[model samples]
Target: MKLIKKNTERGEEKKKRPKKLKRIKNANPSVVLDRHGNIIRRVDGTEHGDEKRGGQFLAALFEKLIPPGTKAGNKKQKTEMRKKPKRKAESEYNEAVPYDFPGDIIRSIKNTAGDFAGIIGGKSPSAGKAGEEKRGGIRDAAPIRKLSAIRRKFMSLSKAMRRIVIALSALFVALVSVCALNIWASGFRETWKAREASDAEKAALESILDEAFADERSEKLRPLPYRTTPAKLDVRAGAAVLVDTANGCVLYEKNADRLIPPASLTKLFVMYIVFKEVEAGKITMDDIVPLPELSWAVNLPRDASLMHLGQGQTVTLRELMAGLAVASGNDAARAVAYYISGTQEDFVARMNAECRALGLKKTYFVEPSGYDENNITTARELAEFARIYVTHFPQSIEEFHSLKSLDYPLQKNLPSWQKNYGDTLAIHHSNTNPLLGKLDGVDGLKTGFIYESGYNLALTASRNGQRFLSITLQGQGKGTKQGNEGRIHDGTELMEWAFSTFADYEPGKDTSLVFPVPSLASKGNDGKFVNLVPAWKNKITVPHLFGSTAKDSADAVKVVVDVPPYLYGGVKLGAQYGSVKYKLGEITLETVPLVADRSLESAGIAGRFFGTLAKGSLEKNR
Candidate 1:
């Protein structure tokens, strides 16, 4: 009965242990993890028992040639070793071997294993060569009889069957190699093409002049390509431009530099001044508008648009802005101007001051509401101002300009008017912007129609976070049948072309920057790293790839940061310490400047000494 019990226990132990691998034999000591018994990867990230490091193709090839038998450890001592705690030296199991490959030793093993494999496949091996070479403990240990047994067994088979198997194996390997090469080459080609821009593309990227900016020190922007205008686009306007604000690339332009009246687009600057005042806490959106007698509905010109701010009517700054933007009301603009400044003349001066401040060299205003045809700006200048305006006050687009219609004198604010007629007196006025809902993504912006300026629309739209700013001046429309035909045609055609042709590409998602600094080598700090920052906004407009981060389509566009491994002493603030490269896979698309976050100095005696060492190390890395 005791013998039966002992036999049963032995059988259970054999089942608990795994079956030995049929093809692999351990040539070196294999890892045996005690604490992490089930995890495939160890703490340092190398796979357990995976110490062999060499060429991938060679390693995979040699793995199959290893014989089945493995050298055994002392079974009794192996069991006892598990009870001992892991030592400091044992914990660094992955770093035990250096990362470099073994040269001659590995080559010798491959020769021996390769010859043995050749024999199995019916190819004759050079006699005595396998016996002459025994490399680094890996040997062809099989005797001569074993070779005879393999040859005889192989000869007993059908030769045609063996040849067919060999052909299939070779074909499989060839197919895999071809597939891998195709994938690699495809990515390489895209990167190469993106980096190699054509002569036409270079002409398209020429910089615009300082006229687009109000401030001389502001960041420069290129509105449109100087050359290579899109073919087949027939835009008939006195002046016109379509620009992507993300990378500031111009999609289309016609007489962009020609001077023309901005029409009601002048209200854009008035609203800009008001928003700036509001942000500075000088005024609030709820402030009661100081209504002047000249701004009254009865006093405004007969054909002019009006918000109907009648006697005893109370209006807030917010309501007037909505009316000014939505109705293109001359009364609302006059009242807003008077409320913000004492008189229309003073307010117009402020508008001109703001224009000059912004660098609108060709733009000046004599009146606030754009009723006067003499107020001037070019298509290119207006486009630049629109970009700055939208960037400065993004919320105004949704709050005021985007309203589809304006209902004047709401009962709550118009107590006197509402008390007389209640809700019946409130009049609905449609937004002056014609492109609002008729086209996708159209939002708030001002439009004007005067004999001096014809029909003008400073249009802006956004979809999926990509925004376009356009200025169309002097649309030729005399009657309802010809109503804003030029402006509408130019706006729709250019917008559709821009959206289809180019999209914004955001850069510098993850710099993946790593640098080492010698200790005590930096000013005011004892650490071994310095902080880094980008010198400019990480956005550029690219064709047909919109709203994508670098991680999404890395093959089309990626950002590579080349940071030095060590800092040689301290760095100055805003210095160009390294570079940020925008790449399409392996090829660089554009290179921008990268700067240090703060100033660093080699302050102390110890710092200077270590800084010298750091300098030597950094030079070697370079």
Candidate 2:
């Protein structure tokens, strides 16, 4: 009997057939699991094993689907099957057992029946071994035959999976390429926008100024370039500046911020402060300024701008300011200081306070005049301060700049010898602003120079209804041998260049694309359909001066729409439909959505009735 059982088991195992792959009629069979035990991705035949994040996802998914405690059982079964040669051929296991055996019963049976015949014989109490083997063979053939009948099913599914995989790969590559291109475009756009200048504007101005300068030079006009002779300055020891007022920008500079001596330029702030006081009613033109005797001895050589104040001289506050702004007057600065604060020291403290308020980032003053080296500032800071001063006190400053000279009345209380000094003498004063009485658009400003402060100008001008402020400093060159002519020429060249080669461009509507909506409405509650328009126009100014900060060319561009809440459906016009804020160097420009902001009218009377009926039917079914 034992020999008979052994033969039966061998025969049953040998007669087993291959398993049929499960499939739908006319559909493809599922793929075998990949190396990760994950079913191959149906979209693409490219196995999940080849993808970046697929392995971990597959592992997690397998962990969830497999039965609990089945891991060890499956591993043991696989190991035994590999060792047993016949196990590899035992694929015909298609029929499911009708009854579920108890766990304990199944375990005992599995342990006792080590081979195929043992299990079959247990199921049949008296069946012969030959019969058992024959029965097993017939049953095994059923699955193999079913698989053959459905071959067409799996073929179609596999082809579709291959196409899906290829398409997905192409799409991924294209998306990556677009992202890279956008990044490159952003950086290039910034680089192009930084140095945008208007060459055309400069050319037009140059055509005019070059003729003026050439005509003056041909005549060898004294002080035409506003200098006695060619001179170079050692800016390392001190500094100065010259400015063009037309472009509202800088012209020339050299260590202008380096601390040295602030000559009469310190009085520029004093003038600004006094004017502010006058505007605020703290003082007036008629207010008396008590002259101080010591002010005359503050700076040696007496070259400083002054009205030669004597003690007890009662000078009007307005006259004192005129002397300071026009003549760089030290004595006038002192008189104003004394009249306002009763002491020069207190007045200097106020000067320091005003500097901070004006956004003069690099200025500090120790005295009212440029005599003290301790009082100093950068040309840029001075220019900014001057611009602020001009903007605030346009009338007074303009009058001050307009002066060619001034006269002082003899002090009625002065001694006989001093009486001759105070007279309405012909004071021939030249305009100090480099561009003053020079450039057509140029107007009155100030000029400064000291052994320690070099030549400086805080200039401003207007052209085509736009104003500009520029400053030049420390152009005295390496030695006193250098000339202001070169500095003046440099300032002119800079100003002329600024007005050319740049233009403001408004974003045209053609680049805009709109999404169409079947339903649209009008704000008047009249029109049935309305198209959306852009809310704001986008503008960009191109070709600017080197080192100039980027500015938005668009004066007022934004979004216009037909609907109140533009996005009514799940679909959007495009990825860039909402708003795009682009950066060109330091400038930020924005574009808004072009969407149809309209809706279908509350259905006409008949349409509303039909909708109501439809709603009723749905309600009744529910």
Candidate 3:
């Protein structure tokens, strides 16, 4: 019975094996069978008989040759291959795999493997229908074969060479990323800075407007002073203006609004700021100010006017002012600016602020020293500035500006050798202004010169108890010989003409009529008018230099009175009720405040009721 069972089992096993072989043959028709009727396998574990398997093996070889992500394969299969579990002890596992094949043997194995795959994958179309129907042919296999060759050659390189290639590739990628990031970051930074600057400017403008109009009230517009037909003065200045310091009246102007380079005359504003600081007690004349590094670096050049300040030297604010006003020392100016604001740039900002406050429309300062030609202003605006300066800080002119010469540095702080070798090193400097002692009552204010501005002067003088301020900008000629003389001559001529032509006239002694408004609620004088009197006995100057008589002066003067259209009761005595402007032709020579001569009680309740009724009736009738 056991023998019969064994024979049956062997028969069943033999039948099952033949069925499996039949299925394999059906699937790969190109599979070759040996003489023993068994399948043959290559060294790479692929059936030598099946062309499709050979093609798949060739694709696997080529996968190693191509750059990453360039392989042709099913995405799912590739991803699964990448995610294959890593060995727990990878180092030990690699060490256990003895890959000690000789270079030539290894190369031979790779070549055979590639050739086998290529022959099956790259079959000619006429050779077999099955190969022709396959997706890849010799066209595809050709590139793969080449890639394999290249990969083999790369693997044969020295270890150091492979490492160098990998490092260079990484460096290239890093550089690209950094450059892209830098470009984006730089653009963003610039845009942000511009936005911030615009916002700052907008805020500054708003603040300035708020401060300027804080105290303003809505009122009826006053008529602008009419321009009078006046005698034109012969003047040689490129631009000239003359103003009465008492009332801020423009007596004469020629090309007064023309823009011109201010040159060192810009120091006038610097000194003005200095005086303001003194008044505010931020600094004092007796305080010691250190000579800053920037002052030495910028003003030590021979071309720049300087006070010959030495490195690390300390100076009094008073001495610096003397250098600035009398010697026109640019170094002294810079030092003072730095001492006050910690930087010349901040001082320049303060200057522009003052300009805005003073309503100077056409003035700008680029530097405190005015060494740069970019500093600019109009004659009319500068004359106005001088008026303010003299009115507020008259002592500045008296103490610092009238001097003919000043000894700068007080004592030579430089070594004897440097002092002697330096070219035209001046411990003493003569004032650039030529009219210091030449013209009567010509006290101050500033003089400026450069090739661009030629020569300029801000002059103030008092004659017959009336102070006049004048500005002469851009005088003609070249060098000290012609240019200096031309400016001085022009300024002298303007001052002489101004004082000779105009004489101050008091209206009290003149035949001018003072208009009186009728009192609305006065008890004794019910309909009587009260005579208006000047708040102060102020005088207006009239031009008499043209051989004009007193009658002509009287005829030239026209009065414009500004009185409220309606006066309510409860007006107090000496209260300003209106203003009377005295004009010579159309130009206003002076405006005097008109005051009440007597008080008027509020029309008692009944009086106010009747007054309102009368006003309503008058309007109804009109």
Tens-digit lDDT track for model 3 on 105-200?
A: 345455556545656666532332444333321133443554565555445546886576567657867988766645533332221122111355
Overall lDDT per candidate, in order of appearance: 0.66, 0.49, 0.66
The most accurate candidate by TM-score is 1
lDDT of 1 by residue, 1-622 (tens): 1122234655652223444423323323232233323223443346755544334523553444333344343334434444577564522432543322223223444456656775575444445443344333333345344445344433433687457646765786798876664553333222112222235532332222122222222533474322344646777777888888765566778888888888788888888999999999999999988678888889988988787877667889999889889987888889888888888999999998888787778999999988888898888888888888888899999999899998886676565535767666888998888788877898958788778888888888887788888888888887533646666787888777766666666654454432222323666633344544445553666554323542244336667777655555666545666777776555454566555544457667776774554454345534
> For each predicted model, how many residue pairs clash, with residues at least 3 apart or on different chains?
4, 64, 5
Error of 2 at 156 (Å): 59
TM per candidate: 0.60, 0.43, 0.52
Task: Give stretches of model 3 more than 4 Å off.
Answer: 1-232, 297-299, 412-426, 506-539, 545-601, 605-622
